[model samples]
Target: MSQPNTSPSGRPATLAPLFKASAGDPLLAMMLASGGDERIAAGPDGRNRYGASARPEAGEIWFSSSTASGVSRRGWQAASAALPFAFSAGESEDWFSDLRRRLLNLLAPPGAQAVFCASGTQAEYAALALAGARARPGQKIVNILVGPEETGRGAPLAASGRHFLNSAPFGSGRAGFALDGWEGAAALAALPLRNGAGAPLPADEIDARVCALVRVARARGAHALVHLLDSSKTGLSAISRDCATKLLRDNPDDVTVVVDACQLRCAPAQVRADLDAGFLVMVSGSKFLGGPAFSGALLVPGGFAESLAARDQDIPWPEGLADHFAYFDWPPLLRDRIAGPFGARCNSGLGLRWTAALAELEAYCALDPALIEMAKACFQGEARRQILMTPGLEMDESGGEPTLIPIMMRGAEKGAADAALRKLRRRGLHLGQTVPIGGREALRLCLSAPQIVDFAWRYREIGDQNFAFGPLRADLEKLFTAWGALLG
Candidate 1:
């Protein structure tokens, strides 16, 4: 055996070491061999697979909002700074308390209370549970799907043990049914949740349908608890604010509204309006905020705590679910009773991840609105121009604006879009992943703060140039050119 190598800085060398050992030590030898391979490939491209290269993979654009994101340099810096606090003395004090309050001030409606959770899925579950607890004796949960594409899986869990319509089949894939059953608190889907187009439904129709549903629930000895999706996979503003407001006003007792702002793409005015009207808005930092994946929170309106306290002792909160919400610094009433178990056991990594997200959100908020709009226009104009010009590509213009652009590929092959995407990824370019659109595979070009700042795709190349807001003609052209060549 031999000692490990060291760099001039006294840190371990970048490469691994191997040495001869006894024949009886086969396991140790194998471990040494694996370590050596890891060291050599540490800086190489595609070493860990997924096509990343040593010299920095080119055109590593990220448009997938759900799974992952390209964290900005500032975000990484904030994480590095906040990590020690999270690991050490951060637990005793509410380290993220100030951060959460600031975020609520910036992103949520005035006077809204926030509850931090691990991911959008978890937050949605918590929101559903909270709403279900408020359900009246004859009321049932009604989820109206704007499209057949289901974005949040935990949604149907609110309807667990109750029959729900228009939701994805129960127990599809890895997800199972919710365990705790609330008496009249179970969710009931407003069935046939199928809308192919991404355009907004008519306001009158929206109001009428929601009100009618509430009436039906009332007649059945139940209130209609609606989880209206403001934006899901399809894009922002999926449900009309006018409808949400009208429903709330018309059926104050019969209807409870939860605005699914999971994408975090809702405009400031829109979010404030919803919150002001007393709607619960759920948002994730991982999406439009461009933080790491899975960080999310649920914003509760003022007086919500009082309303929850007014309810009887039974809220049907599933056992063990309280642990995920342990990060929230609850108000006195909730602190003592409702969510006492929460914050009792917290995850340091989640707290650190949110701190990083807060950093990203801060940077985004700091930029001038005019500059962001201008850059958005520039990027969208160029992208649309090239997409139309490209023979194999077509733009899905039903929903458009600041970010999350969807484009359809012209071809008959089942996996044509994904196949071309793989080719580009192999060439060091990663456009967003493939998603089902209109019964076919399509691609999304989601823009984040890093992309808006015109940072190069290579992680190391960011911050090498001054931040700029200008035409993205070159970048769009490059992406389409590569895609065209691959199609050819």
Candidate 2:
């Protein structure tokens, strides 16, 4: 492999490796190849199948982390740094194990474990498998997904123990078949977070519905895998943490609560709290963390694996799972619990992607907590203000953090919103994809951790008084200006 040219600061002189890692060993090829199916495939136009390129583009404003983002400079550097080592340790467990350890240290509480997957949807599939393994012999697995419309398109299929995609990340293609040993093992129940009017339902109403479903599942000898959505696509959470806790306490044996924190927009403390409460948490590096797409992990609370171990029930590993996950994906404690001749290999791309994401996360976490909150507040307030002030655009007022702002075009025809999105992208302003809210389709303006950290640094350098007049507001100004032109 050719060596990267370095400058006096010891950084690569160019981002060549960031876009395409230098070829040395065959393992580097595997790392680049593992971005998964159509989700990350680049098209003939040099863009990924998602219409975004793998490499970061200059002057392209990215407000799309609520869906996906190209690899940020920080993430790219981290991935580049890992390349040499990843090549050296081809298929070895050391690199993957260390990646898992780093993830747990950064996001999990003590004794917590993590199962890495190729994407958030894949993590959902892993969660279902774990829930299915824990079900009693006579009990059926009933998956209760919150905010199904706002979550991944493939989530329902994954929750039902079927292949959500035509091809798995690891190069296995089996579109709609039930996973091996999983046929007739699980059923899906969806609880919409919003009512028919596109209005968010009351928390109490959502809680009541969840309780009713859990009770029904329990009465029917079913294990209820209820999801607590921390943040959906447009940043709306369905069930409150307190409600999830109560349901778990009321039906500990029959209830399995998984927090769909795939957006990863909540605080680390919130995730630790979920783990402390014995709930499985799913997080994505590709979302708010601003990593390259297709990086996700399922966080297992401490002692949860031991509990599964104690069950000693012979849980047959679904043969289809071998296509999506490798042996190293699970922590040591879980490897032996599910019996199967699974792949004893490692996914180098998964490792590299996590490495990149952890870089962004660590940098963001290194900033002052107060500063982080302040930056988010300023950005959200300004972005919301601009969106409201813009003509022909209305904000979707579902209760969520300001990180993701969903706005709809007034009187837009069917599919016009999507065309407008393409127009905005062509004009060099990138926002989130269109999401359906009630009868209207809305586009999102999202804020990522890297964006916050960037603003925070500028804020610190320029002092608090000049902060408001700085780049943060300037970015919002640029966004609203482009939006207004599109409306015109």
Candidate 3:
């Protein structure tokens, strides 16, 4: 491995043998294979950065701490340095302008306040609160929630939440929703769950029912629950256009759309189409936005945010603040909607890191596109091909439309998956493994960050007996490639 040539930070360029060397070839295996790497020493880029972690092959690993550490350091500095506009953002309009302009171009929406929050969950809560701000206290606020019905989804419903219209069928009564297959979307819409409940319908046939959900809302004399739909997970692109057509009609004014773009930075362009159709865009920097887990943002559409802002004339909440939404907690910023229009941010170390990471990413993405494609074609693409080995390793559909490409070994014997995992660990390779969709054991090979610049060389280093890379290489090839060798 080469040391950083002219790096003032004294950081080594390649993976260090003692700290990074695996049983395989490369001596300097990065921590978060692609997206994040924590450098023991500094580099020319900065003392903290380790350059986008998470790139790996079938037999390598990616670490998180590396890039996370970098993002944290830089973001903290930038955010802390920000003029702490607790009340007024009279001067920082330019900075916010770049942010706002980019958002408009991507979301393709007109009139939006690109505001930052602490995290995605907070963004969701804030979006809901903003929506619920319209509630006339007993004015039926039907908060429609669609997701796996886990992890803070219930927060909004509890607040002015009268009808939790599950866009899909759910098992657990705790706002249970079972919206997975196309059929499920239809079934839930068929019976409409009767606002409260009645005869539960199955989604087996009426798979396209999700489209008619608006009709259900109208019938129940309720408004759209602002659809807490996170498109990052659900591939809204795959949904039949026939179903979403009416919803997609350009009516940014009539309906209230609050999108949880938790996986924003990594998301493709079409995602903006969804945001453009909404009254609010909730972006979280943690997931794919390349920031700490804490910092998130709420990009509110146009003048609506000011309407929801806490003002002198507006009565304080709990004077109508629902208990369910009491879970939406943030150090309140007393911004008068009328006094000044601006982005009110929380004092968070992670928040600082998020801003810096964004700046870095924005810069990197502004390079030569053809060169970028050529580089990807030569590097990561090849690595991906190599990792999808072994016929039985089935890739599961990631909900968040994950930047991490995940593969699950389906129907493998109880010890089979674990045995494979152990073998990889011995070889100094790690994987993202978990209990798969149907109680199945799975392993995911993600190509997201600190990458091996010389991956091809590492691939060739296998089985050089003088080093450990050789034996481990044989072991892995035997596990999967042995069959290929036999056939060959």
CA RMSD per model (angstroms): 10.2, 5.5, 13.7
Cα lDDT of model 2 by residue, 164-206, tens digit: 7787765566666787767888899998988898888888899
**Alpha-carbon lDDT of model 3:** 0.37
Best by lDDT: 2
Better of 2 and 3 by lDDT: 2
Clashes of 1: 11
Q: List, residue by residue over 1-488, the lDDT tens digit for candidate 3.
A: 11112212222325223332233212112211211112212344322322332212244333222112223333333443432321123222334434445544444455555544434544543554455454433333344444332223333333232223222111111233321211111112112211122112333222244435555654555444344344423222122223333453532323355555554533334455554544466665444434443345666644555455543343223211121121112212322322221122223233233445464345334444443333334333333444466555555554423334444555566656556655554444444333333445545443222121122223336722224233333433443453223223
**Alpha-carbon shift of residue 107 in model 1 (angstroms):** 1.7
Candidate 1 residues 1-488, lDDT tens each?
Answer: 11123222211222212112233123221221121112112233323222322222234555555434644455655655554444342234446566667777777655577777566656655666666667654346654444325455444543343212122211112235343233444545543233454344554565566667667767776655566676655463444667777777877776778777777776666677778888887787767776654467777886665677666654545543543455233433443345333434345555655776787777677666765676667667677778877888887665544477877888747888878777876664556567676566777777666565443322124432223423245556667888888767
TM-score of each predicted structure versus truth:
0.76, 0.91, 0.52
Error of 3 at 316 (Å): 7.9
Residue range with the least summed lDDT across 10 consecutive positions in model 2: 1-10
